[model samples]
Target: MLGAGLLPLGVLLFGALTDRLDANPIEHITHSTGKWAIRLLLLSLAVRPAQRWLGWSWALPLRRTLGLLAFTYACLHFLTWLVLDQFFDWEAILEDVAERRYITMGFAAFLCLVPLAITSTRSWIRRLGRRWISLHRLVYAAAVFAVIHYLWQVKADWLPPAIHAAILAALLAARFRFRTRPVSVAQSPGGS
Candidate 1:
């Protein structure tokens, strides 16, 4: 599963080594990383719905793995922008963040992921307990900002972002739908 989760990064690494990336390597890497970040973020968020609907409790552990992988890709995306695109020009970066709506949304998405990644460890989980869950809910916000950033940044394509938005809407609806539904005694906790 981890290897599967890493498949996109592996492909990116292979592209780098083989010089298969297009004329604009920075743009290619940035888009690839951001795309995978949102993909994995949505995947991680889907874990709970899968568990609730399919009774696949065994899949729960993958949530953290997917979340962390999403964070990794998000960091890579941000670094590609900061280092390759802006050359660490903090002034220019700040100006872009302030002036560009897409950049602002992407920056906001990255910021949301930071603390979630920091506190993802089991030790932090044990220490923080319920609060950890609340903090991690930031994933939803991250997903929202990421999709909007992608959608808003694309100059020519709307299909991809529209699809992402639809998926997010479905996931959120499923989350609420499942939460509001009453669990029956037949499906009560730990009956086995």
Candidate 2:
């Protein structure tokens, strides 16, 4: 699981070292990291559905790892944009987040992820108790913002973001359907 999560970063590094990232290396890096971040985030969201529908119980444990990996890629993506593209210009960064809808969406998504990542530890989980679950629900909002971010950023192409949005819709729909499912009397609490 760790190896799988690190593979994209390794490949990105290899590309940089080999001079294979093309002329706009920063653009390539930013896009690559953002793509991996969203892909991993979606994969993490899929884990619960896979467990419930396909009975893949082994996948249940992977949710946290995948989410953290997604966060890692997201951080890299943000860093590439901040350090390489914007050259640490806070004024411009704030301006972009304020003026650009896509940048706003992506920044919102990153903000949603921050607390979730910070509270992912065992000690934090114990400290937060039930509140932890509620807080982590921000991941859904984060995913939504990320999809919007990707969709709005595309200049001419719509296929990629469209597909991502469709997948996200399906996943959220499945989750709602699962929650609303009627339990048989025998399956209800304290039923004989």
Candidate 3:
């Protein structure tokens, strides 16, 4: 509910404040939206580790919401670039997608996110069952693409993107290492 409400409100607020937003208003909006999308995507991915290690089952419900929010922000980022920045110029947008490495990487990430978002519903979960897990695994690829997109866009000062990429690598490593590790029984102070 908050995601749905805040999205439109954000658009409206950005639209209203566009004049005073920044020197490159569209670029500012695009970067801001993309950043939020990547952040939410990382947060969504963290939910599983949080649940497993901290045993915070309650956080499970928020995973879907976070994933959806990531998709929402990604859409906003794409639209801001296509409509606002390019003025709906399909030819120019196509050229950019074809020529710009960062744009291509970003587009790939956005495209991968689409199916995951679509299949996040309860109905899809029920319909796909165990297969749903494999389908949603695309998020890993999306994260990689997102990191590449950010890295490719930076002309200099690779520090920020490198940090984000390192965090993503650590998160993914945690998932792989802990995913199948057996939970051993804790021995009581008194031997059984």
Put down candidate 2 lDDT per residue, 56-142, tens digits, no spaces: 999988999999999999999999999999999999999999999999999999999999999999999999999999999999999
- Candidate 1: the clashing residue pairs are none
RMSD of each: 1.9, 1.0, 4.1
Model 2 deviation from the true structure expressed as Cα RMSD, one decimal place: 1.0
TM-score of 2: 0.97
Candidate 1 residue runs with Cα over 4 Å from true position: 183-192
The residue pairs that clash in candidate 3, if any, are none
lDDT at residue 149 of model 1 (Cα atoms): 98
Better of 1 and 3 by TM-score: 1
At residue 108, candidate 2 shows an lDDT of 100
Which regions of candidate 3 are displaced past 4 Å? 1-18, 180-192
Candidates sorted by lDDT, best first:
2, 1, 3
Q: Pick the candidate with the highest TM-score.
A: 2
> Which RMSD does model 1 reach against the true structure?
1.9
CA lDDT of each prediction against the hidden true structure:
0.93, 0.95, 0.87
Candidate 2 residue pairs that clash: none
Per-residue CA lDDT of candidate 1, range 59-128, in tens?
9999999999999999999999999999999999999999999999999999999999999998999999
